[model samples]
Target: MTGPVVRKCPLCGKPRSAEHAPFCSTRCKDRDLMRWLDDGYALPGPPALDEEEGKA
Candidate 1:
């Protein structure tokens, strides 16, 4: 059987249409940009340690 259809927009969790296969619409795409600009999203990474860097 075919894998579960994964045709939803990653930014807005809406079904992706042919015109905007990865984003429901241009608006949703812009919304994702705004979120980035406003720091609504975050990246997972290791925390900085002063001791490791011989700073403390």
Candidate 2:
């Protein structure tokens, strides 16, 4: 019988480790970090106005 849905690693479909949490291994973890550093992820929203620029 199915008990519950087990959470899988987002980087790869593998069992998650206690240390890595969401990622399967350090490599996947590092890869995810690199993606963020390279602006691989972003949020959609209107651009915020610069308060200082408004004063000028």
Candidate 3:
């Protein structure tokens, strides 16, 4: 088999830690969560209309 591939952290580009898996540390994890809560990330698609609004 080949050597194990090292995965870099998504936030800081540092080597990933076992405890945090994809994230390098607690701070990065919290930062990702905050981004989600603050709407820093968004799904790509057309706006979705409510059922009643669609009928109108």
Candidate 4:
């Protein structure tokens, strides 16, 4: 029989660490956080309207 599947880190493709769960290490985890904090990731959506335009 085959063994349980091992998930890799999304950042470096390394085997995931239990402590970090999805990421392999604190560095990768922090990098992901930085991406979010820096607005490196975004979701698909309609463009936001300006305050002046919305007020009209």
* Top lDDT hit: 4
lDDT of 3 by residue, 1-56 (tens): 99999999999999999999799999999999999999999999998999989994
Instruction: Pull out the clashing pairs in model 4.
Output: none
TM-scores of the candidates are: 0.57, 0.71, 0.77, 0.86
Ranking by TM-score: 4, 3, 2, 1
Identify the superior model by lDDT, candidate 3 or candidate 4.
4
Candidate 1 per-residue lDDT over residues 1-56, each given as its tens digit: 88878688897688887786578998988888899999899999987578869765
Record all residue pairs in model 2 with backbone atoms less than 3 Å apart, i.e. clashing: none
Model 4 TM-score (2 dp)? 0.86
- Error (Å) of candidate 1 at residue 17 is 3.1
Model 1, TM vs. native: 0.57
Which parts of model 3 have CA positions greater than 4 angstroms off?
48-56
* Candidate 2 residue-wise lDDT, 1-56, digit = tens: 88867778898879788799888899989999999999999899988789987786
For residues 1-56, what per-residue lDDT tens digits would candidate 4 score against the true structure? 99999999999999999999899999999999999999999999999899989995
Q: Rank the candidates by lDDT, best first.
A: 4, 3, 2, 1
Reference-based lDDT, each prediction? 0.83, 0.88, 0.94, 0.97
* Among all candidates shown, the one with the greatest TM-score: 4
